[model samples]
Target: MARSFTPKVVTANRLIQGDTVWLTANGYWSSDICEAEFITDAGTAELRMIDTETQAHLVAGAYLADAVMGEKGPKPIHFREDFRTRGPSNYAHGKQAEKVEKNV
Candidate 1:
């Protein structure tokens, strides 16, 4: 028996900055996962991944990653993807630092 296709989003890392990015419906990349284009069909998701790969200069490691449609947008379905959304875990650097610096 065949399993149904789960929702997904095309994801990649910016070639220069190496920051995680997701493909938007406008055929562009955004650092915010909430802007990702939610694909509910496996075939469509695969096609999106291929299309995203054509922009080699803009991004790399382009691939279709599992996701679920949320009220805001697509959310990561796996631990790795969820972890990536939070930026780095360092308490003194990255997203964490930005929050701390703002509160000071």
Candidate 2:
């Protein structure tokens, strides 16, 4: 039997240092940092990756997912680059921005 596609969101660490990214959908990601764009359930959410110190927002991607249920809360998501660079990134969900600066 063919498997059904499960709805999912693509999220990544705000500070990713890599050339290419692999989102949930294979072959749908971008290598050019300038072309990065968030993929959400409602559709693509335009985003920019900003340098924490310089405050320069570079075009980037963001993803969405169903809010986590009871106790679990919203699960955190990370980019393929982040995973390869630093293993699985810590989950922050709503506070991802705040947590990004802190060491994992």
Candidate 3:
């Protein structure tokens, strides 16, 4: 029997800034995973990956990541993806910085 398809979201690192980004429903790349398009089927995930991969100049390491629906939006299912959502770990910068500033 064929393996069941798991829900996923397309993700990659922006080539210019190296920030982790997800493919939104409108085809825009968003830094927030909550804004990601949650893909439920294997066929749609494959097609999305094919289109996303073609944008090599804008992004790198594009792939489908396991995710689930959240109260706010899609959420990452894996530790690696969850870590990526937090931006760089070395310091407070990028998304992390923005979040810190907002909390103050």
Instruction: Output the number of the TM-score-best candidate.
Output: 3
Evaluate residue 100 in candidate 3 and report its C-alpha lDDT on the 0 to 100 scale.
Answer: 22
**Candidate models: Cα lDDT each:** 0.77, 0.31, 0.84
Residue range 1-104, candidate 1, lDDT tens digits: 55898888888877987767888888888877888889988778778867875799889898888998889899999998987766756554443243311110
**What's the lDDT of the predicted structure labeled candidate 1?**
0.77
TM-score of each: 0.83, 0.23, 0.85
Off by over 4 Å in 3: 88-90, 99-104
User: What residue pairs clash in candidate 1, if any at all?
Assistant: none
Candidate that beats the other on TM-score, 1 or 3, i.e. the better one? 3
Better of 2 and 3 by TM-score: 3
Cα lDDT tens digits for candidate 2, 20-104 = 2323233234332222332333323222212212321322344333222224222323454333323434653322232222121
Tens digits of per-residue lDDT for model 3 on 34-99?
888999998899899989867898789999999999998999999888888886788876676664
The candidate, 1 or 3, that scores higher on lDDT is 3
- RMSD (Cα, Å) of model 1: 5.1
